[model samples]
Target chain A: MNPISHSPLSIPQQAYSTELQHHLFGRQLLAAEIPFSLDVLETHIEQGYVAKTFGIELDHCIRCGNQDKQLFYTFPCAICRQLCTYCRSCIMMGRVSECTPLYTWTGPAYDFHVPKSVMNWSGTLSEGQQTASDRVKQVILHQEELLVWAVCGAGKTEVLFAGIEAGLLAGKRICIATPRTDVVLELAPRLKKAFPFIEVAALYGGSDDRHKLAPLTVATIHQLFRFKEAFDAMIIDEVDAFPYSMDPSLHYAVQKAKKQTAATIYLTATPSRQMKKQYRSGKLQAVTIPARYHRQPIPVPEMKWCGNWAKQFQQKKIPRPVQAWVNERLQSKTPILLFFPSIAVMETARPLFQNLPAVYAEHPSRKERVQALRDGELQGLLTTTILERGVTIERLEVAVIGAEHEVFTESALVQIAGRVGRSFAYPTGSITFFHYGKSKAMVEAIRHITSMNEEARKRGLLDG
Target chain B: MGFSMANCYICYEKMRKPITWTSLFLRQPKSRICSNCEAKFAWISGETCAICSRELDESFRREQLCLDCLRWENNPEWAGYLTKNVSLFHYNDFLKELIAKYKYRGDYALAEVLAPFMKECLQQLEYDLITVIPLSKDRLQERGFNQAQALLDILQINSTELLTRIHTEKQSKKSRQERINLPQIFRVTSRTAIQGKSVVIVDDIYTTGSTVRHAAKALKLAGAEKIETMTIAR
Candidate 1:
């Protein structure tokens, strides 16, 4: 028979050391996952090539920086044979127990040599976009923070090209993080096309580029937990999105993932209350792009009383006004997006709308269905709040079936309204909010859009 | 206890335990997993093999043993070492992922999710001593916990360490024939405690049954009166 197999570390020491260095640079990995023997790690630690910290210490997760005691749990560890505390907050990535050590390379860093001119994009930015783009570059050069409070369809991603190029040419690493995976999937390709020379690592939950050391990275906020002060410049897109706005651990991960002197740029269509308060108090450097790249005002949503739509849905009938609106869009051959409060309501009312394709957060073919609507292969699609942001369809007319539901917060409604009139080819479209009774959020959403339009008009940023 | 709220260990969803008169007067046990996640675990029921507790089809009903067990029984060297093996769940895809997350990824809290089922199964078995299949020192350092022992700890069952495993290549990479042909990997640690006592062996999964059989053989050779195996999946 064959002899016992050797561990992975049995490879020649030179090749193994280089491989370990490649994986450990700019990353805080568990000691068990280092792929080499602990003796080698200890030698590296003694030589000041690696820094090791307890994975979890005194109810704190050093890797993810989760300090909440409720998120920590204890279990009897077989290796230590003692009660070990683990962080449940970031357990989806990997379990960080008290006995485990997080390793980071303190040796020479990975060198990224970028081209002189990284940006290949030829499109011209609008007057509003140019202002925000200049401010972003200034923030990056000064190593400061700035909030770009741009309206939806204002080409926020395009505005970051110059800033990213500046960081790249200066021999700095940059990362663009969003709260959702959909945004990462949407942004990575466009950023790659713009900066064709720079390596862009698109990291989400099962991304292949998780271990790649790149000059530029586009990732979800959750993916930042594995990084340790890895970026010289960090851009947070969709700063007001879910989980990022509500979860404190994600905020901690963002801070822990960036260098202490790194520049930060927050991009959002609807900033959180605290962010807006900071802007109003002159504590935050901010710029507002109220006009779309097409130099057009945002389409304000019109509130229409649909008379107890939920009750009507229970009767297996669509509301009269909502039905009329769908027919109007269908007759005109305009693609439409109908937002429901929840998946159950959307599925229940789906049959009444001539078998329109419905999508939610958990829908298997959510991307394909949204792409079909964008390509005009599907006339209209029903969706939940998951499609409120990061989905753009040309000439798309939007309507919210149950706008007064608690799920339709003011920011959500504003995002839903922003879905209309996004494309420059068809920069004008209709948005309607069909509700049983007008809620405060519906009114605020309408006011929020109207004020942005007025702001663009006052500044002469709007063409019409 | 009044109405209480707890998050599931598996999915982290908030579970609301409704208050009733019995709950007010009695100390109700809290659920470790939410109903949605708990429903995914398929319990082993209906017809099963008498030897290894593998769910059997109707075609194998006549002999009451799976074909693999028949092969093991025919081998004189391996015959009658393990009395029987009882498993709680079928080795379905969900259980496969759960085991990977629990045992390989070091999510130690997941043992609590399987503790109730294991406790129920162990209550019906007649054994004077219970012990878990030992992991090699190298394997234990990598996984950070012995999955089988973790289940016993969550159930509050004190298990004895009767066997120590010799380091070998991972069993998952070996074929069926190779696994069966492998030599004894376990050495009895405490011969006196196992002498003349009925023993139970616990493991995470019963795939080829060779691992437990090896442990049973070591215990049987150590003068144990009887040996049986218990596992979370087969």
Candidate 2:
């Protein structure tokens, strides 16, 4: 027997997307949906002249990524590569490189992929993906515009492979714009392996490879300011994400960055009411994926209002059902994640759970805490919404302290709920909400999930 | 009241809309003989330095050069390319007061009145395009708008952001040599677009000519064929 095989893997381990598989096909996928027009591109090129020459000045060292506190020209690290200063840590690691890719990209293509070494990796697909992929392919081939709407967990990333393949095959430049840096880092390696032959550029706040300026660029939306109608196709992911959605400047930037004849695509999970109104009015076009690939119904976690909750916990007593649930998980030894609304409450209740012998952790604690969670060194973690997106932990039971907190919007709650029941082997799980007051948003969120799960079940795509 | 009545020297009200009058006389209750101490100043008129916009004091004063030419700080080979410059009044008390109010007082409506004077100041320095000195981002945001650009719009000239500031500091506080020692601060943008273009650099004043000199340096680097400067006051 394999010594590491004391417990069965809860989910079928997915094969690492090899670098060869990435290159086997030639295209790329974008993170957002953007509009394209030749006129807009020309205008951007004309207007962005001043922005091109504006020199960026930094007050401190770039090597250690320290800012403001460090002085210029002093404590220079020898690995110094760019105009910016480097620090001792970067010098020791040989990481002192200039900040590159400030100017928009030009030339070369490559594939990207997520390496298999990452844990808790389970991606789902839907029939809509093939249709969406085909649409993107057609848009690129004909230089058209497409709008895509996928429900949470609808496997939107995989759909881009086919579109990127077409861009590479045709030798046209492509770019994917997102609002978050974490997403860019997460997506870059995946694309690299998925199409290794094509040179791909991943741009974010401080990525080292930014200077290469590849033909295919993956960047945050703010970086688009440096470009002028530069891409043959521009994809804007999470079209409904905050700050990006609210800022007209970003929308204008995307429009200005695409070629007059370029293809533009938009992707979103929870499009705003205004977008829906426009789509209904035919001012915009859309395609949606409403089901998960697992074909299992999305689980609906019921909320229980535990009034006077602090009083109950102070009596050296935990709620009977909640205690029973934790005890069951302890007996089974399944790692669990307990979410709280604030760090203060987590501190107060942390001791209550210490007697159970399960390691407890929360965010904003320390870098050590996050590492501990990743290493699976802790059995249960109490956290805030900081971990809502871009984090994956395998086979964990999940619970929430206050589902009705105003901070947990419909979109946030949905994304939080998405954390559970992700793997094929462990496609079913329990989610409990301990709320002091019930909110309509909570009801609406649960309803939305049930409807999507019902649709997935109807399509026979649920995993378990 | 004779001194006040002496302000009425150029008093013809029907002088074809009197293009750009000094704000000292125009922005006040019209007792107009040039009210601030009633000092007489030469208004830039006929043929002058085609490049520097230096006024011709006399018809026979050689078509394109001025008294300041002996100390001019640019290449002579490029000297004759620009037209005449019309500086409305010497940088005196009355003009200085109006400029302060117009530039720092958030008085944008004053731009409508000032634009024509700026236009009249350049009556002899014929230019194909006009551009205002570009403000650094920090300064522009603080002031809400560029004053020179606001007035230039009234001249109906298409403008571009051709210069970028390397650093910005108050010029009045710096000495002349310190001003000269200041590095050439403007960098050219869209070099190919400005090739062989003749441009008139417009500003509120012409103190020491440093800002215009820097701006002219950028325009020259960008291949501007001829550069002339025009100001409401020198």
Leading candidate by lDDT: 1
Query: What is the CA-based DockQ of model 1?
Result: 0.54
Query: What is the CAPRI rating of model 2's predicted complex?
Result: incorrect
| Candidate 1 displacement at residue A190 in angstroms | 2.6
lDDT of 2 by residue, A191-224 (tens): 8776676678898766776444465789888666
Q: Can you write out model 1's per-residue Cα lDDT over A191-210, one digit (the tens) per residue?
A: 99999987899999988998
- Candidates in order, interface RMSD in Å: 1.6, 23.9
Tens-place lDDT digits, model 2, residues B1-234: 112212121321222224345634567434323433344443555555544455557743444555454344354632443343445556666567656655653333445546655554566666666777888876664444577787776567677777778878878799877876687788887788679888877777877666777788678767898777777777
Query: Model 1 over residues B97-182: C-alpha lDDT tens digits?
Result: 98888887778788878878888789999999999998888888777788988889888898888999885689999998998888
TM-score of chain B of each: 0.94, 0.68
- The model with the greatest DockQ is 1
- Which stretches of model 2 miss by more than 4 angstroms? A1-126, A142-145, A242-249, A308-324, A344-351, A355-371, A460-464, B1-234
TM-score of chain A of 1: 0.93
Q: In angstroms, how far off is A67's CA in candidate 1?
A: 2.5
Question: Of the candidates shown, which would achieve the greatest TM-score relative to the real structure?
Answer: 1
